[model samples]
Target: MGEEGTAMRMVLCETEESRRTYTLNSFGQTISSYEELCYIISGQYLYFLTEGIPEGMREWIEEELGLVLPAEEETKKQLEHIIGYRNYFTVPEQRMLVQKMRTAYLYSSVRKHKMLGDLYLKHSRYLSAYHAYQKSLSGLMQLKTKEQQEVLYHTGLCLTRMFRFQEAKEFFKRSCRLKENKKCQEAYFIVSYMHGDYQKFLEDGRALSFTEEQLSEIHENISGMEERFSGSEESTALKKIDYHRKKPDDLMTRRLTWSMLERWKNEYRREIV
Candidate 1:
């Protein structure tokens, strides 16, 4: 009985070592060499290891190899690169980079489309940007949890640019609820202001419905512009019309409003004989 128990212990020990050996070999397959695995653990080969691997696989590889990988640091660096690319690139350059990233299936491709959407919106190419933003949003939707809030916020920006203000407001509100980020707050305020503007324009036929503070700000801005043009002959010849009086009539406003309302209408309009 003593000899049998000793044999069982020996078998268990061998099985554990074999399992460890298999894990080590699997790590070897993923990396270039045992030396490269050591470099990865030491944070020197992180870029090479992460280049072709998905985000989910990195931790598993780290655990199996008994290595401590700088996954968070690498992610942060990638995000910084994405933001820099967005801020520095021109419209054509951004579009070109987005196209290349998409073709290569790079992890940054979704972010590139999102940044391209913003560039297009800045250039006032609203419809084109909306498509790009939508694609970014779709890519993010596949991710779990609230990881896609940035994509949602950018989609709201695209909708607002396209003059789909109500839809944009809803999207922004949802994004704010999800992430509570500064971008979402800014989008919320813009949507709220635009909603009020659209209502004043359509319902009351008012050029603007400003609060006291907003009126003061607008007056200050106009006064500043007036000073710049004080000596110009063109400024003297310019007629400052009261836009309130010239506000579109109810009939015209209704036509504009109904155009959007018709999109939500369910009935089909048929031709009469």
Candidate 2:
């Protein structure tokens, strides 16, 4: 039989009880949580389960499938498999698995996009990561506050790395408004300054009720940024342009600015915060 036919035949021959047994016995426990489900099916990308799954995502997947998702096992064999997969799985294979996890499994739209974004961000695919994060934004209200903050923060970080400073600053600002995240707030100020909106940065700080100490820190950061660019042609060129310009207008300045931005992007630790 063909592969598809064989797979279909196997599915046709399987009973719910048998499926349950297959899920439970293979993993050595009932799948009681989304974290366990995500961990096993995705093979080794444990960070996929970093965010708490929405409460509504559980009932449908569990109740309809009748397959008891097993708990995460810490057995030597399982650990070895996880390690091997991380070490050996090709990027294409991992990407394909992410798609399968999105489709074959019943994940909410927000959850699916968040998972996609996290995977892309982890791999340093900033453009794709930004797209995935953008997909999750409309559904942010459905997620908890922490999740919302995470999505926004990641989106901003991706834009920042791409050197879309103005757009990135808006996301960071929104994330800061969601709650008082020091990282988000700092990113907001840094990107605002980078985008040549230093006046608004100071205004925003005051409007947000930033403490004197926080304002001092921002000033320190500004001075540090100025020091970094002091001798660079990019900084000199940028200053000659109108202060309101979001990006460099001259071709040489654009090239120089991109190179400098790359250095700043490299300074960022590759982790979702």
Candidate 3:
């Protein structure tokens, strides 16, 4: 017979007891013949017995049993309430509850990894946070969503702090490609700045096409940092080399020169503070 005919023949042969056995057996639980009918009846009355049936089959089961199943919405709210009480749970208890929720709600692996990553980040465990973020990204790569940006951003930041700059740059660049996320823009800028290619920084800034206010703020912050770092005798020698290389023909270069001097002054002041 054809596939559809075979399926129809199987359906026609299924009695109510047989349907119940099918559902229970699909979950791999063996039911003794003596207890099967009683178990099926109990499952019908409590509505707890349709564990393995797909959602489309649910309507068929309800029609055959002459009873309505509880709406999934109501069941979800009840589960959420039971799991949301933070004060009642210890660390291990909270972890167990999160795992149970993952299974119960059929949360995808990416979501589960992201949740664990966030929890570890909150606790200041950088290595664990990095691992979870990596796992989250691996799973999230299969889906089409903006959530991937968030995972990449966090992973990049963690890797950057861990001094894994090349890997971090990859993530930061990926994040910047995704639409107008201010955090990603800032992260990209910071990573470029750290690489110390001033020309690249200027090029990236142009590519980002920041607003006037953003450009002004970035200029001011760079000036402030240069001033702060340039005050020392050691910094003075470094500034002279940077100045020669940059070739101070423009107003911006001159301002950068003065900012370096100011940083030295601030450093001196901090000794007295």
How do all models score by TM-score?
Answer: 0.33, 0.51, 0.44
**Candidate 3 regions with alpha-carbon error over 4 angstroms:** 1-105, 141-144, 206-220, 229-273
lDDT of 3: 0.52
lDDT tens per residue, model 2, 130-166:
8788888988898789989999999998887765667
Global lDDT scores for all candidate models = 0.45, 0.58, 0.52
Give me the displacement of residue 249 in model 1, in angstroms. Answer: 7.4
Task: Write model 1 residue lDDT over 102-142, tens digit each, in one string.
Answer: 44345565655666565555544556556766777767765
Query: How would the candidate models be sorted by TM-score, starting from the highest?
Result: 2, 3, 1
Better-scoring candidate (TM-score), 2 or 3: 2
Model 2 segments beyond 4 Å from truth?
Answer: 1-104, 211-213, 232-260, 263-273
Distance from true location, Cα of 46 in model 1, Å: 24
Which scores greater on TM-score, model 1 or model 2? 2
Please report the TM-score between candidate 3 and the true structure.
Answer: 0.44
Top of the candidates by TM-score:
2
Candidates 1 and 2 compared by lDDT, better number: 2
Compose the digit string of candidate 3's lDDT tens values, residues 100-126: 544544656677567666655554455
